[model samples]
Target: MSSYADLLKTPGVARIIAAQLTARFPNGMLSLAYLLHVERATGSYGAAGLVLAATSVGQAIAGPLTSRWMGRWGMRPVLSLTLVVCVLSMAGIAFLPLEVWGYMAIGFVGGLATPPVQPAVRTIYPKMVTSRQLTPLFSLDASAQEIIWVAAPVVTTFIATQISTVLAIVVAMVFMVGGGAWFIASPEVGRVRIPRSKRAFGVVLRRPPVLLSTVVGFLLIGACAAVEAAVVATFGHGGPESGIVLAIFAIGSLAGGLALGHIPVGPWAMTRRMLIVFIGMAGVVFWLDFWWLSVWLLIAGIGIAPALAVMFAIVSSSVKFSDTAEAYGWVGTGQLIGAALGSAVAGFLIDGYGATGGYLTAAAIALLGVIVSAVFKRAHPDLRGRDASPIPDTEPVPVQPS
Candidate 1:
């Protein structure tokens, strides 16, 4: 499974992975595209930021509910409905000439309608492949996702700058529709329906492993946000160099994720690797030269994807089949909130104390993740080579109408 050929050989795996990636491409592009479009329209960065914030807020609010809906209603119908709403909202943002409030409301609606593609696809993975294939499959999925982060910005920026911002957004909308359609049409997605949980949504989060993973995942992603802010600030805010720095960081993550399946390490080793990288990043706070900063970020990014892969594995193994999507949605929400908080905290610190403050914020957050992991290690028995079995699937599976 180390090679791409072996991974692609899994029946229907390639098709679903392609569908998932295609559906997710816009996720990486939409924020920057929306920001550029709004800024161009309003002639104010502040307005653009507010619109983007609205979008994030909407997404954060909807993520768990959407996941719950997917479990309740099944993937095809829910995804089809959300995708249509998302597309319409994108078109509204592209075509309408709205004030800040208008833009914010539309952006919020767009985000609220954003498809839960990641959680849906991930939840389906275990059912698609054997237990032995799960690790490499997740590793491949994580690594491939880096392509979206790296490519979407380049494509969006080029189109927005060379053509019209409106056109760029339209292009993203086209991709979103096309990808979502492909995913919804896949037979595998249509066939599977996760049993609904008898317990309340809050009960799922009450599980020890779920709770710990959510918190740790939040801090880890928060550290990433801080580092991104610091990198941009390091090169002077809005500098062209910031994009390259981020791309390189993503490349490092891609490399690490590709290597994860080959490594013979316990689950806890993933956390240790993350801690070491964060320490290295914290050490680089003293030396703020651009070249050195880039090198530091690259090194720091090496564990990002692997750590995420580990987190996904842990969450998948720890939760009931019924709770899988919602559990992931909770983790996704943590990452989103953490990112917003990290950027806000880093921005405030950078204003007062320069790039050093941002770097330090990132380090502190990473260390906090380490502390949380250590303290709650018992919750994650998988770290110690023991499976954290799901709460039994006692609920009856609903019959799908043919």
Candidate 2:
């Protein structure tokens, strides 16, 4: 706790974290918003799933490309442009009276323009604090991000159910505009310049740790996405229980992240954390009652942030400073892909087999993640007693006249 206090006390650390969290808050809201909005409009969860899938595909493509662009073009310009395009797309989804295809098209466009806020903020963390502080910072960031999960669902559900689903999306856009502006205006975003990678694109995937993190992160988030769709489907017609349950789940994640943030990360750390999630989610399949689902999900949520923090630290420790942005980009892309597949598969299953299908999908994805993490224990960097900062890029100095 003292370490976290010190990290927060560092200039611009708290501000940047807060601003970025606020800016990225929409990431939490949009999936559920789209799910409910499209489901109501098109009268099918499968159609809603398609829209979410399209948006995530766009995001998957954008993650690496946009993050790399920040290195060449600068953060403010790239972020500012994406912010405008993304907001407009969100508006289109809310206001445009179009067929399911129209919504899918706009969702894809919106995803392509998804701001690289996660990558940007993460890249800035290395510059903000000491090497020793870096891992804890990652832990803190991961844990804190649960705030988005905690609040976004509750708020989105309330609005979508009580007022209108369209209004829920409008509120998300407002957060995007306000929070994106705040993040862009922050000094650290301007201060930290991501060095252009000398390595060609896609080269970062060659690193074992980066690849391992990307794979495990894909499975982990896919499991999470499945749970989310399941929760909404279970309680979407039952009032605010969906929001409350999801928020409770996020609260559990926040608690776990904060409690486990200072613990040393070993090669098997991710596997251990993922097992916790798998066990909890596996338990969820036995009972579909409201209380039963919430309790199991709360337990599952406890492992989410800790697993994510480990992934972030491992990637940061493995890559060069110049390649960090792109590495994180690939990592983000994996998660988005996971979300897309998880949501789509879960939606289809829910339509056929009911909420049980969604829970089963989540448990299966989580179990797979655990197995992958354990098998690749050799690839997970032992961060204990080691610096977690990005490898400094070596520049070639010109030879002077001898």
Candidate 3:
């Protein structure tokens, strides 16, 4: 029996995870660093909040855009090229004079160039790891991301305070470049290229759970985005407090992610609990009617990682070896679209109406995800039972190779 690490010999999975972890670790740090920079420059919480919002908006839009590159060029080219672009973008942000557009541009480039790491990672599993082992592996990956991103703030904050505000941002940039480069430098995974003209994109969409999981991911992101926007505004009351609310949510998720990974939490059992938890949290946003936004967000935030880890594990299991990137790309596309929409709507509603509007919007979308998941399950009960059967007989009628 091979050890856990031995099973992960797929060059693609290891490279992709390395790139993603490095990229996200600093990207995670950027939030706190950005918040500080904005506050210091403008001396206003509202101003900083706007900056952060723009950053979030930019990143959300980037996911699918980057995923397309992943689908077309394969992980190596996509990851490498994106890293270069991100580095330049960060440099621009660091050196350019203080202004909202400057920051937005910086954020945009970073988002646009980011590798669709999750999809790449998922794509490699069928080849790198055994079918029965997928759940635990994905769990480990998800858990790693949570830990890195969660604690990254401490280092980021310290760097920003010690060296310069821009140093933290610069470090984020450098990390992406170096790490992403390293991932692709290994020929094993990077060597596997996807031809640009491989069948129509719709072909992949035809897959059952692939499409279903992707759609679910998108709707879920929409709900979460709304929650993010609303909770920040609600607990924060204006600007300075936004960081605290985000921190609360992130910390809760950190704990949840680790538990989902290490604990023998039954995959299906945890999933059901997550679904129930999602609805309950959505309900809490309105039911409690509490002015203290922190408490509401903290209570609901614990579900974030556990829910994602479950979804990812399910997604990893759903696709064939060939369809990994495509499946993952669709998932990213869903999230990108949902998050952008959520952020835009949240901004408008919060700016005009209030926190309640944003919260209601988030809750409604989350409910829709739950409803959609149910509908999909009902519609494709065949798939609900079909993947277990052997790979549909692919043997060709007798043909002579001559």
Candidate 4:
């Protein structure tokens, strides 16, 4: 707690974190909003899902390219361009009376223009604080992100159900424009410059820690998405219990991150944290009651933030400053793909085997994450007693003629 407090006290730290979180809040709202809006318009979950899938695909494709572009073109221009396009696309979706294909096309375009806020903020963090503070910053960040998962859905649900789905999206757009403006105007955006990578695009994925983090993150988030779908399926009948349970889950994550963030990270740190999640989720499989599921998921939530913190720290330590943005881009992409795949698989399984199938799918994904982390323990950088800053970019001197 003292460490986190100190981190917030650092200049630019609190402001940047708050601004980015606010800007990124739409990530939490837009998914549900899109589902409801498109479903209402097209009269089919299938069509809505196609729109969502198209949007996710556009986001995935955009993450790396846009992040790298920040290095080549500069943050303000790239972010400003994306922000304007993204806003227009959301408006098009809300206002345009189009066929399902039209919605999908616009959604895909919106995704492509999704601002690379996550990667940008993360890239800037290393420059904001001391090396020792970096790990805790990442931990604080991972924990703080739970606020989005917890509140955004509730806000979106209230607006969409009580007022209108279109209004919910409009609200999201407002946050995007407002928060994006705050973040872009920050002095740090002008201060830190990501050195352009000399290597070709996608070359950063070759780093072991980046690859390890991406694979593990994919599985971890997949498990989380599975659990979310299963919970909704279990309590989707004329009640708000599902929302309450998911909020509890996010709360648990927030608590765990604050409590365990100061602990030194070792090669096995992620494995241990993930094991806590696996054990808790495994308990949910045996008992399907509402109380039992909530209890188990809350326990699983304990490991979520801490594991993510490790991923960020490991990647930061392993990549050069020039490549950090692109590396985080790939990591973000993996999580996006994981969310899409996890929900799709959980839906298929639930249709066949009931809610238990979803829980089972979640547990299976967590188990795989555990396996990957454990087998490749060497790939995770031991951050204990070491600075977790990005390696400085270097250039070779031109050879003098003999």
- Give the candidate number with the greatest lDDT: 4
Q: Give candidate 1 misplaced runs (Cα > 4 Å).
A: 1-4, 237-239, 262-267, 383-392, 395-402
Give TM per candidate: 0.94, 0.92, 0.72, 0.97
lDDT of 1 by residue, 1-402 (tens): 446567688889999999889999999889889989999999999999999899999999878889888878788888999999989989988999999999999899988888999889888888777666676677788888999988998899889998989989998998899899999888778777877766687677887767877888789889988988888888864567988888988898888788765453364755675786686578769898767777877877777887777777777777888898888888888889999999999999999999899999999998888888777777765534343223447756664642
Which of the two, 1 or 4, has more lDDT? 4
Which scores higher on TM-score, 3 or 4?
4
Ranking by lDDT: 4, 2, 1, 3
In angstroms, how far off is 295's CA in candidate 2?
Answer: 3.0
lDDT of 2 by residue, 1-402 (tens): 999999999988999899999999999899989999999999998899789888988999999999999877878889999999999999999988889899999999999999999999998899889988998899999999988878887789889988999999999999999999999999877777777777888999999999999999999999998998898888876587877788888888998888888898999899999999999899999988889988998899989999999999999999988788888999999998898788879989999999889999999999999999999899999989999999887873222121
The lDDT for every candidate, in the order shown, is 0.82, 0.90, 0.61, 0.93
TM-score of 4: 0.97
Worst 10 residues of 3 by lDDT: 384-393
Tell me, by TM-score, which candidate is best: 4
Clash tally, candidates in order: 0, 0, 0, 0
Which 10-residue window in model 1 sums to the lowest lDDT? 383-392
Show pairs that collide, candidate 4.
none
Residue 347 accuracy (lDDT) in model 2: 87
Give the Å shift of residue 258 in candidate 4: 0.8
lDDT of 3 by residue, 96-157 (tens): 77677667667666666666656665555544555555555665576567656556776787
Q: How accurate is candidate 1 locally (lDDT)?
A: 0.82
